[model samples]
Target: TFCVLLAYGMLQQITGLRLQDSLGYSSSDAIKGTGALMTSSMALMACVQAIIFKFSVKNPARLLLIGALISVLGFYFLYVGSSFWIYLAGMAILGLGMGLMFPANLALLSLNSKEHNQARIASINNIGKGLGFAIGPLLGATLYQKTTDLPIIFAIGLAIITLILSLISMFPPRIKSVHKI
Candidate 1:
């Protein structure tokens, strides 16, 4: 979570001021409204994930997979957005996907893990997030520099990858036995 946050922070920090200046807008306005919008979506997603977990913690992967696919659609909206309303709408959907994945992934991992190894599992998951933060900016910059169409390329690529992951996640081997303690 922190890594994703950091990655987004870096993106705004690096590009927000410049983009605003280029567009003849105040620098502070560049990223000012995003947090408010994202927070609402995140809060709603947290509630949904909690409710879903109550029913079937063991099947949260299904939720994550679907969420990932939704993320792709959100990205598509963002990539082609040419107006404020469109951009905000895309952001709303993107935030929804993000919100859905976070808790759902954690719940699924917890369900699959042994209680004694919970800490280790969490640590490993966090490590991947850290790596994403550390690397996201460089990758983003490279793509941005490669062509003027960075957002579209990124949205398309993310959509493809998410779709693939969603497909894979849907087909997990069925657990045949339920152990009761």
Candidate 2:
């Protein structure tokens, strides 16, 4: 959750700036572009999540690594792209990635929790999200100052970590092996 949200924050911090500075958009135009990207991506994510929830996918980590991979592609596209359409497409792809991961994280939480403590467990998700979003932009901005690609690179690193974490979560508790006496 933190990894995903942090990636979002890092991308959000730079996309608008890229539109204005790199693509030579006017301030109004940049905002509009950014708004369009954000709204479309969010809508796509919501729709995808809804569909997943409707089907009640049992494997919580199934989409996690895939989503992270897709997100890496999206960020890479943004890194290589220099046009408005390209940027928009990149964001849309990232949105698809977000769609895959959000539900998985929630499902993981629900699967790991008891009915009584579900709300408490859920709060932890919110906390991870808040911290990720909060820190991402600050870290992103500093990295962006060094090089625009830094945030994307950092995001990719986080995605890799998400993959590892998701892999760990996918397994059930290990059983102790008995030795023959």
Candidate 3:
């Protein structure tokens, strides 16, 4: 949740600036373009979420890992992209990655929790997301002030950390079950 929001927050803050500076768009046009990009990303995310739900029943961990890696790839595209179309493509891919991972992670958390505590856990999860959203834009903006690439660099680092954690979760330590007579 944190990583997801962190990436998104940074992207949201930077998109307009990128459009104006890199694409030679007017201020109003840049805002509109950014809005369009964000809307397309959301639409793609919805579609991807539906597809993942239909196809990926077992091995959500693998899906999660794939999603994280895909997000990294998306960020890489954003970093290197010179055209507006490429930026749009990166946003779409990022949306797909977020769609794939968020549901799987939430489902996994739900499956691992007690029924009574489910609401609390969900609330906590949302709180974490909220915190990430609140903090990420500020951090990204501050880093951007220093250098345009810094926000992306920070986002990539966070994505890498998330990927590592997902990998670790995939290979959890085995537990021995005890039999009672």
Candidate 4:
């Protein structure tokens, strides 16, 4: 879970620079554009969160799976897109996924954890988020230096892995019930 968030944080941190370079924007314009992009992403995330909260209280695990899949698509868009609008759209999609996955996963964690360990779990969660914030940019920048799209590839890989793991966790193998005489 934290790994996914970390990858996302890295992508969010560096996407502006990539957009600026790719689009040939002046620094000021790039900053403004990045701001707009981030704001749009965040706004979409908030909306998704609100909608999920209102309507999807019964099935957080399902929501987490959906969010992970959506995030994979979002990363794919970022990897393949060249235009500003396309990138913006990708960011918006990523935001929606983040909104869904973040809260849903947290809720699942809280529900599953023992009461005595709740504080520890919460602490670990915050640490994961902090690490993501710290590491995402550094990792993205290093990968970007190696290849233009490698960071996006890395993010996509992370999202895919996360999605696969979520699927596995959500749908464990079940034993059939036997009828007794």
Which of the numbered candidates is closest to the native, going by highest lDDT?
3
What stretches of model 3 exceed 4 Å from their correct place?
Answer: 177-181
TM-score of 3: 0.91
Which 10 consecutive residues of model 2 have the lowest summed lDDT?
Answer: 56-65
Task: List runs of model 2 lying over 4 Å from the truth.
Answer: 177-181
Candidate 4 regions with alpha-carbon error over 4 angstroms? 172-181
Candidates 2 and 3 compared by lDDT, better number: 3
Cα lDDT of model 1 by residue, 1-181, tens digit: 4433433333433344334533444656666644544554566667766676567555667777777776677667656756556656765676677667777777867877899999999998898778767766666566566653563456457556655765776677787998899
C-alpha TM-score for every candidate:
0.70, 0.88, 0.91, 0.89
Error of 3 at 153 (Å): 1.1
**What does candidate 4's lDDT look like per residue over 90-161, in tens digits?**
889988988888888888888878999999999998998888878888998898888878888989988988
Per-residue CA lDDT of candidate 2, range 73-100, in tens?
Answer: 8777777788998888888888888899
What do the candidate models score in CA lDDT, each in turn? 0.61, 0.83, 0.84, 0.83
- As a whole number from 0 to 100, the lDDT of residue 45 in candidate 4 is 89
Model 3, 6-65: lDDT tens digits are: 878888898888888788899999999899888877888899898877774587778789
Candidate with top TM-score is 3
Inter-residue clash pairs, candidate 3: none
